[model samples]
Target: MTISALDLAAETKRLLTELGVSADRYIGGTLRVTSPVNGNEIGVLKEHSALEAKDAIEAAHQAFLEWRAVPAPKRGELVRLLGEELRAAKAALGRLVSIEVGKITSEGLGEVQEMIDICDFAVGLSRQLYGLTIATERSEHRMMESWHPLGVVGIISAFNFPVAVWSWNAALALVCGNSTVWKPSEKTPLTALAVQALFEKALKRFVAESGAAPANLSTLLIGGRDVGEALVDHPKVPLVSATGSTAMGRVVGPRLSQRFARSILELGGNNAAVICPTADLDLTLRGVAFSAMGTAGQRCTTLRRLFVHESVYDKLVPRLKTAYGSVSIGNPLETGTLVGPLIDKQAFTNMQSALEQARAAGGKVTGGERVENGAGDAFYVRPALVEMPAQTGPVEHETFAPILYVMKYTDFDQVLELHNAVPQGLSSSIFTNDMREAETFVSARGSDCGIANVNLGPSGAEIGGAFGGEKETGGGRESGSDAWKAYMRRATNTVNYGKTLPLAQGVRFDVE
Candidate 1:
């Protein structure tokens, strides 16, 4: 059932009560959650102390000592139970995601579904963490590689995808027998709490059924910059998975590197799509519209730039303008609403500033003005379309708003260069009916983004494929397709029989 605003408040209160959290305990130090839908206060939460952050890391470290001893497939059974818990709480938690993160109802539910899907993927991967065997120079020696679980995994997620990103790392990290400490976005702590509550529920049942499992296998640290820094600087956290803006990744990537630790960073994406002359306009229209506007263009994979062949530029531009005009911008929980309010006033201001900058730079921009008709000061705005004469100024970087920049390209070579010119390489797509064109786009000489597509939008990546990007996007992989390897360390081993002191490369120094 779709959750309404009235029911959401009551449900949140009930959930807090059931989780043993009381507002009276928070007192003066509390975070007041205001609904972006109507600018009303949702709930106030007590932030975690900095010392508590250290305690959580120590707990995860203790858990890892026991967790890594559990067999791989047995760890899978625990994840399977967690998946079942997510399925049961999908509606209520999804509703919380919608209200807190400003996603439309469907997108909110879809994010929860991503959590469930990754759990399923991790369950299957438990038995499939394969290693490679190598040929040895000596006849009596056998050489092979084995995978061992790393210590604690620290996850820092962004507000755009409150729950799914955490699950992507947590599920794989858990199945690899590594405990995790998650620090979700300060803007969306309630969803994090809700998810932690559900995980504990599943963990309790699993322990009862399977004897003793590791305590504090998963933990939550809810606070702002100080708490996040505590996790990042902690010595026990060997692998830190962070998802946020490029500026944030620039800081996190180096800090983790300084300690010679591992980090998986899913940073900002200024993705684009190319529409060829041989493309199906009907299919192209839907792909471009959704990728450009989905999540109010807040996703890391949102389509920010569009390169259209000159032949169809006239036809596609007008259709796109109409589509942008027709999009319904209002409360995300309302039925049939396509575009929701910006996460806050600053997001609205950023959109406005970008539009103004485009106009000042002599680019023809349509739409993108604030929508004052919605809830009182709710920060709603129309998604924009800008026809740029050149890819200069604000069009070159991402503004984290519903602004799609359109440019015309005369040749395929020029289109490819334009598509790859941006610094961030997270996702890219092409719409073409020509087989050769599609093949070339997927080839090594083609798109440089981590994810490449044909006749499809760049947003909404599936869980089965490894999700990450190259270059400034951090060069880290997550989700599936052997991403589990990142959660473990590899060691090569050699065993010898037949009483021969055979050295590698047939060394003769041993004869002395």
Candidate 2:
């Protein structure tokens, strides 16, 4: 059933009550949440204070002490239950995510599905947190490495992917025997509360069936910079996983490093796609359209830059313009709407400002005008296209919006340089039928991104691979592969069974 806006609001209130999180729970200040869909006031949240944030950290740390001893397989079972809870609440929580974070209905549900998928993945990963066994130099000595859980894990997520990012970190962290304390984006606190409530429900069920002490394995702190800073600087939080802009990563990366704590930062992506002359234009058009405009182009992996072979540059730009004109822009909850409003006026302003700069820098910009249909100051704009003479100027950096900057390339090396020119290198793709070109793009000297693709756009990463990037994009992986290892510490053990005290390199020491 398609939930009405009124029903969603009521569901949110009920969820807040059930979760024991409302305006009264926070003392910092009131956060009035306005829906970007139609500029309506959805709800208000109480911002958490520093003391409350510290208390949450303490709770997660205390929980970690027992959680680490629960055995990895048992932890996986709990994650399985969390997946079930997410499955049960998928629609409602997905709808809440849409309402709170300006995601369209389908994208919202997909985000929830991502959470469920990660839970399932983490459950499987519980038993597979493998360590390496080493060959010993001595005859009677065996050496191996064991993985132990890190203490408290701190997660700071962005508004664009409020729930999924948290689950990506928390699910693996939990299965790896670490408790989590999350500080979700203040703009999307309701979704965080809803997810936390569901997680707590799953935790309760696990304890009931297993007869284990109910540890507060997961915690949510709803607030702004104060709470986030507290979480990042807390001595107990040995690892902090953050997902946001490069500027934010610059701040978070240094803070975590100063304390010698590990940080998994999934930061910004000025992702690009290079279209060769021999590329499949039809498929390339579809892939680029979604990559450039999906979620109104707010995705970190969104294809913000396009490098087209000069031979097909003339053929592609017009088709891209036609595609842009067909994109449906309206209320995100509506049936056929594809492009939703920006997160707020600031995002809209960013889009406009970026376009203006593009125009001033010898670039031709089409679309990007504000839509003033009956939505009442809600920020909406047509997905923009900027034809640039070179990859310099405004196209050099990332502006989180549906703006695609197209540049023509003459040579393969030039195209690769254009693709790698941007500072952020999260995801990159090249469309070509030539095997040599395809192989070259994926080679060590080609794309410098963490993810590289052939005949595909630079978005929609699967959960199986480690997702992150190089340089300013924050070289931290999350959401699959051996990313679970980040949540644990490794200790090498040596066993000597033959009862002889020996020193390395045949150096012997005798003590009385």
Candidate 3:
């Protein structure tokens, strides 16, 4: 069963209204918002121009100056309230995510849960923004390093994990005493609007309960590349945390660097998983299936490549094929549907192009045929499982679709080499029961990706760990650990209490 355009639109309108977004405020505009489930126009938004984006950045900068003076715990209070607001509207917002991004119901809710989790994490982080005291050589001298909020934070998010990625940065940035300006993907602006509306509610409550709060703490810029570029190039925006394609990163990174601005780029990933001879076939199958096919393989951490030991290769491949054949693909909102439609016709076209290249590279492909759901213009397809001779061009490059390239390896050492050969390194996993193999896979010389799992697949990452990648995936981290430091600036200080000048390395310069 598929959702009709009218039903989808009605559902979207209801969700938005429930989340405090009035229809007349955002529904009439030149930019059309559509659901990937049926390719139906869900809403319309007036795109923010480049000038408006710059004004938003300036407003965020001014808000940051005031917000930074607030006590750290007080800043945390606002995030705590935001968490409450997100919890209250999780269902409405999660469904909006599913409608906009084509995520399954569970995945959609999981994304909102991520937002709430990050808010909780940031609330805790607010009081724990620690500074370090260094030992001084000179008598009666003290040295330390402190953190202060950077100006405005610019966030550029993609369509796949629309709301979650923004929260990862915004929550941390807020706790760090920085204001944010967000530019969501053109494909999924409604979710951004919904999130901002919820945030506004949280802010209002915070102001009523607390003494003061910045009204422009979080601003949304809805537009295309031009608006995003304005955010990246703005001098007031000292840091820009962007999540999108490597191609987008290639442009964003340089533009920021030209101004010496900081960037946390969450780019593309060609993730892979290795299966050992001692691996539990049942556990490995479940891990591989969800990681490869979940969210239609649009996750940055989606497992796109698989390496199985020759001993278990023949056994696992057939089981995987059967599993792929049994997967239910249809409307994402429907229960029991494991796979949802790709974001649009372009995504379908890209998937087909990658499959053709895989075939030319001597691959045995199974599935990947388009499914004829009743929804008009929705692009649903069966996930493809390909047995490849080697890691060819198509296998190495990241394709945002449900295509898993499988290969067999006789030696562990050689397989590790093949795993790290790709240009993009985001997430990787190895399924092995052997203690030595498991340790080796996660060891210093193990999977080269930023996130390496012993028995788990790489798709779902928790908020407690720093998330990102190396190489072309952009060597930037977000979500947890010391990721909050990226949103602030550091300063070193030396104070002398005695009437003597202090010098480092036993070298002193005395002013005459």
Q: Top model by lDDT, which number? A: 3
Better of 1 and 3 by lDDT: 3
- Clashing residue pairs for model 2: none
What's the lDDT for all of these models? 0.88, 0.87, 0.93
Question: Compared with the true structure, what per-residue lDDT tens digits does model 3 show for residues 1-512?
Answer: 33654478888988999998888756779899889988888998898899998888888888998999999999999999999999999999999999999999999999999999999999999989999999988889888999998878899999998999999999999989999999999999999989999899989999999988877999999999899889999889889999999999999999999999999999999999999999999999999999999999899999999999999998999999999999999888888989999999999999999999999999999999999867768899999999999999799899999999999999999999999999999999999999999999889898899999988899899999999999999999999999988988999999989997666788868887
What is the overall TM-score of model 3 with all chains considered together? 0.99
**Candidate 2 off by > 4 Å:** 1-29
lDDT of 3 at 92: 91
Worst 10 residues of 2 by lDDT: 1-10
- Candidate 2's error at 21, in angstroms? 7.2
What ordering of candidates by lDDT runs from best to worst? 3, 1, 2
lDDT of candidate 3 at residue 74, scale 0 to 100: 94
Q: On TM-score, who's better, 1 or 3?
A: 3
N/CA/C clash count, model 3: 0
